[model samples]
Target: MRIVDTHLHLIYPDRFSYPWLATKPRLNWQPWTHEAYFAEAVPLGIETALHMEVDVAEADIMGETEFVLGLPRIAGAIAACRPEHMNFVDQIEQLSEHAHVKGVRRILHESPDDLSQSDLFIENIRHLPDYDLSFDLCLRDDQLYLGVALAQRAPDVTFILDHCGNPIPNGSGLDPWRASITEIAHNPNVVGKISGLVNHCDPGWTAETLRPYVEHMIEAFGWDRVLWGSDHPVATVTGGTLTDWVKATREIVSGASPDEQARLFHRNAERIYKI
Candidate 1:
């Protein structure tokens, strides 16, 4: 099946400051340019990709989008933003001018839970629909309810829940994660990304090991609301290569009907990100 990687992070250390990479040596091995990603992704059936922000320093947010959008086959970008700030509207307006800026994402998983609870954050998020931009929700498993709450508040804004709410299939965490998934799926505005699981799962994780989580996500979100993401270099930490994860992901759903596979591989992403 053809693939549209809804979550692709391209890192350019020389042009942008990625302070988080200092502690992530595996992902810091080199900058993951669009050229590098396409070289690996093209042969594996990834026809297009939406460049997910790497959480670059605030000053470089627009610059990062500019750089990635210049590359070939990058369908669009999900940019980083500070919706908690009162000035988010200015940033949103500037991003709206760029056709490739498909959505906005704030790395809320690392922040305090109350960060998204702020009135300013909620207020700013409500304005996204005016610009027709979506939000990518990147939260740890425990923070999912907060994600659901945010989506509930801003019914106008489309919310893409990243990393399957980061389920840990190998541990006891599945029950709670599954519960959150059930709740999040109820929000018609929320879409689930069937990715980053490779990064969260055991290093030697297999397709069978990932079946329960993947199957449940497909069932909960329904085929049309689920999207696929490589999470790329981060995924490499657990699955060895983007190609390997694609293979494993394909195997995880190997038994599904062709239509189901098509939706996860690209159709859902096309509708959600409009890429």
Candidate 2:
């Protein structure tokens, strides 16, 4: 089956400034160029990819999008944005003008809880539907309720929940994560992205180790509301390779019918991201 990787991050330190990489030594080794990514991705059936923003410095956000959209097999981009800023409308205006810029993301996992909950933040997020842009919610497992609140307020906008709500595969946080995901999925406008599980797992993680989380996500959101994502270099740095993640994801969901698999692998991505 052809795969549409909805969360590929291509880094270039020479051309961009990623201050966050300083705290993540593993991912800061060198630039994770598109050439290095596609060498392995193409063989694994990833025919197209959406370049997810790498949280580069504000000055380089648009630059990163422009550069990656020019790379081979990169179907579109999920550029970064700061909804709290007064210039957010300008940012979305510029991004929406680009045909290949499918959506925008603000890394809320490490950010303060109140950051996205503010009135101004919610107001800016509400503006997405005007440009026909979706928002990728990169929230931690515990922060999922905030996602629920954001999704509810912006019923007109489509929200892609990244990393299956970013739960830990170790099972300790399973109960609450499941509860939160279930609540979030109740919103018809929200979709789940099956990516980044490897980043939250230990080195010895296997397909079986990831099964529960993946299955629950699909169960909650149903097949049509879920899509596939590689989470790429971050997955590699954290625990596994893009190849391992693809294999494991397929293995876990193998019981589903071909149509169901197609939706998760590529079909839903095409509909959700409009690539």
Candidate 3:
């Protein structure tokens, strides 16, 4: 089956400034290029990919989008956005003009919980629908309620929840995270991504360890509203390569009908991102 990776990050150390790189010493080494990615992905049936934002220097965000838009197999890109900043409206306006700029993401999981709650931030996200742009909500398991609030506030805009809401399987399953995800999924405007689970598991986690969370997400949102993302490179931290993660995802969904798998792996993304 073919796949569309909705969450692949492309790094350009020379052209962009990744201030967060200094703290994340491991990711600072080299750029993850399109050629290198295709060399590994194409054979695995990944036909195309969307370039996710690398949290590059604020100045380089647009440049990063333009760079990815220039790549051959890059179907589109999710540009980095800072809703808290005063220039957010201008940034969104400029990003909307880029034909290949499909969506936008601001890494809320790393920031304070109250970040998205601010009136200014919510106001900026409210403007997304005006440009036909979707917001990729990246929040921790504990912060899901806030994510739900954001979704509720902008019911007209589309929201894609990244990484199965970043559930911590190692911490145990079906507790607060499950309830939160279920509530969030109830919002017709919100969708979930069945990606980044490998990083939430124990280092030696097998397919069984990751199954329940993925199953619950599919149950909550249904296959039609869910999408897949590699969350590559970061998956490496959990002792699973992108190929390994993708293989696990494929195995977990093996029992589903072809149409269900098609929605999870490719179709949902094509519709959501307007790719």
Candidate 4:
């Protein structure tokens, strides 16, 4: 089946400074260009991909957005934004003019807990509805409740929870992650993404290792609110390639009905990202 990847990240270091790459030696090589992604993605039926922001330097955010959206097979972008700042509206207004920018993301997983909890952060996030841009919530597993709380405050804004709340698949956090998944999915505006599990699993992770987490996320969010993503390179860590994850995902949902597969693989993303 054809797929719409809601969480694809492309890194062009020369064009943008990715401060995080310095620590991530595994992904510190040549830039991950569109050619490399579509080479495997197209063969595996990924028809389109939305460029998720890679937390580029503040000055390079707009440059990064323009770069990716100009490439082939890139349907749109989830640009970077610092919602905690008072000047965020100006950036939002500037970005509102770009149809290719479908959403905004501020990486909360590596930051301190209080970063997203501030009143200004929540209020700034609330402004997204004015521009029709959704928010991509990238937080740790234990921080799922924080994401839920933020989403609840902005009920009108759509929140895409990344990496199944960063669950440790085949590990001990399943019960807590499951609870948080249930709680977050209760917000009708939140959608759960079934991507990037490879990053949290063992180097030799199998489809079976990820089956329960994947199934539970779909159960919690339902098909209409679930979207597929490659999360390439990061997903490629642990010796797993994008092709492997795509194949594993196909295997996991092999029993699903055609309409259900359609919703997860592409249809839901089409409606959510307006691609």
Candidate 5:
């Protein structure tokens, strides 16, 4: 089956500075180009990809979108935004003009728990519907409730939950995180992305280790509401190559019918992001 990677990050050191990369020596050096990505992904059945923001310097956010849109096989982008900042509305208005700019992401997973809960953040998100933009919510497992609150506040805007809420597979099944995911999935405005779980699992984790978490997300969100992403270089940290991650995902979803797999891998994203 064909696939669309809804979350891929492209890093160009010369054009932009990624402040978050300063502390992580491993991710700081390389340029992940469209050529490099396709060389590996194309043979694996990935026909198109959406570039997720690398949290590049605040000034280069639009530049990142422009660079990716210029690439041949790239379908779209989920650019970065700082909704906490006062200029968020203006930024959204400007980005909405770009036809390939599909959505916006603020890496809440790295920020303090209360950062997304702020009134300013919630108010800024309320403006997304005007531009028909969706928000990619990146938060840790514990912060899923905050995701719930944000979804409640902006009923008109579509929200894509990244990384299955970042579940830690080493732990027992569905502690506080599972409850939060269940609650968040109850909201019709929210959708789930089944990516990034590899980062939270043991380095040698097998498909069985990943099954429960993936199955729970599918059960909660349903096949139509779930999408797939590579989470690329970050998945590298967990010792799984992008191909390995995709293969694992295929194993987990092998039981689903052909139509359901199509939605999870490609169609849902095309519809949600209008790709």
Candidate 6:
């Protein structure tokens, strides 16, 4: 059960500035270094990982990428980018110079709805293919349609839907989330990441609570289009452990064929991120 974690975030307050963590007291209280992560991860069959960007300050973006790629088992990094800016091409050009930069992500989950809907943002996203980069879409449950719209406009670029569209598994948003996921998968350009749900779940959530959401995503995107991620310290923010997530995922997909399991756990991530 080897895993390729596609959404692991490492925090380094000394090296970079993560202003958003100010509001997230739990995560901000300590740095989540690779050494701390791999101690638990290695035992659970996580071999390698891609360091997802933590939305560091604009000044520390490239520096963060360079720093993480040097860590052990970090196959690559998903660096942060500002597609809304006019100089986005220049930014990607700089990011493209580093072979470890597998893709780029602009945190759309917390930003204003129109942040990524602007003409400039769409135009900038269209340029990703030029640098051989993918985009990780981190939208909230309500903002799932925005992901579909962006995928439609940038058919050439690969879109990895983070957190199974970051669904709110509170029972009410299920049907609409399922519809949006199906629509997103229809584009052929978007893939789904099975991570981040623990943060959205209630304290009492279990594999059964997450079964429907996970099943719908796999059904819509198919095994080949979906991959697993730890979401690490963030996963721990909601009283969920990395080990618990891995074990729960293993339980939920226990009936799938080994080949199908391989695709979801590691194969798709290796191919999609070029890891």
Q: Write the per-residue lDDT of candidate 3 for residues 1-275, one digit (tens) a residue.
A: 89999999877787888887788656677777888888899988899999889898888888889989999899999999999988898999999899889889999999989999999999988998888899999999989998889988878889999999998888856688999999999999999998889877878887788889899999999988999999876677777778888888888999999999999999999998999
lDDT of 5 by residue, 1-275 (tens): 89999999887888888888888666677877788888999999999999999999888988888888899989988999999999999999889989888899999988998899899999999998888899999998888888899999889989999999998877644687788889999999999999998888778888888888899999999988999999887788767788898888999999999999999999999999899
Candidate 2, which ten residues in sequence have the lowest lDDT sum?
A: 168-177
Which scores greater on lDDT, model 2 or model 3? Answer: 2
Please provide TM-scores, in order, for all candidate models, with all chains considered together: 0.97, 0.98, 0.96, 0.98, 0.96, 0.98
Q: Which ten residues in a row have the lowest lDDT in candidate 1?
A: 167-176
- In terms of lDDT, model 1 sits at 0.90
Off by over 4 Å in 6: 171-173
Candidate 4 lDDT over 109-224, as tens digits, reads 99999999999999998999889999999988889989988987888999999988999875665888899899999999999988888899988888998999999999999999
Q: In model 6, where is the ten-residue run with the lowest total lDDT?
A: 167-176
What tens digits encode model 6's per-residue C-alpha lDDT throughout 198-254? 888888679998888889989999988999999998999778899999999999999
Question: Model 4, stretches more than 4 Å misplaced?
Answer: none
Error in Å for residue 198 of model 1: 1.2
Q: Which sections of candidate 5 miss by over 4 Å?
A: 171-173
Using lDDT as the measure, name the better of candidate 2 and candidate 4.
Answer: 2
Superior candidate under TM-score, 1 versus 2? 2
Q: lDDT at 259 for candidate 4?
A: 97
Report residue 100 deviation for candidate 2 (angstroms).
0.5
Stretches off by above 4 angstroms in model 3 are: none
lDDT of candidate 1 over 199-223, digit per residue (tens): 7777787777778888999889999
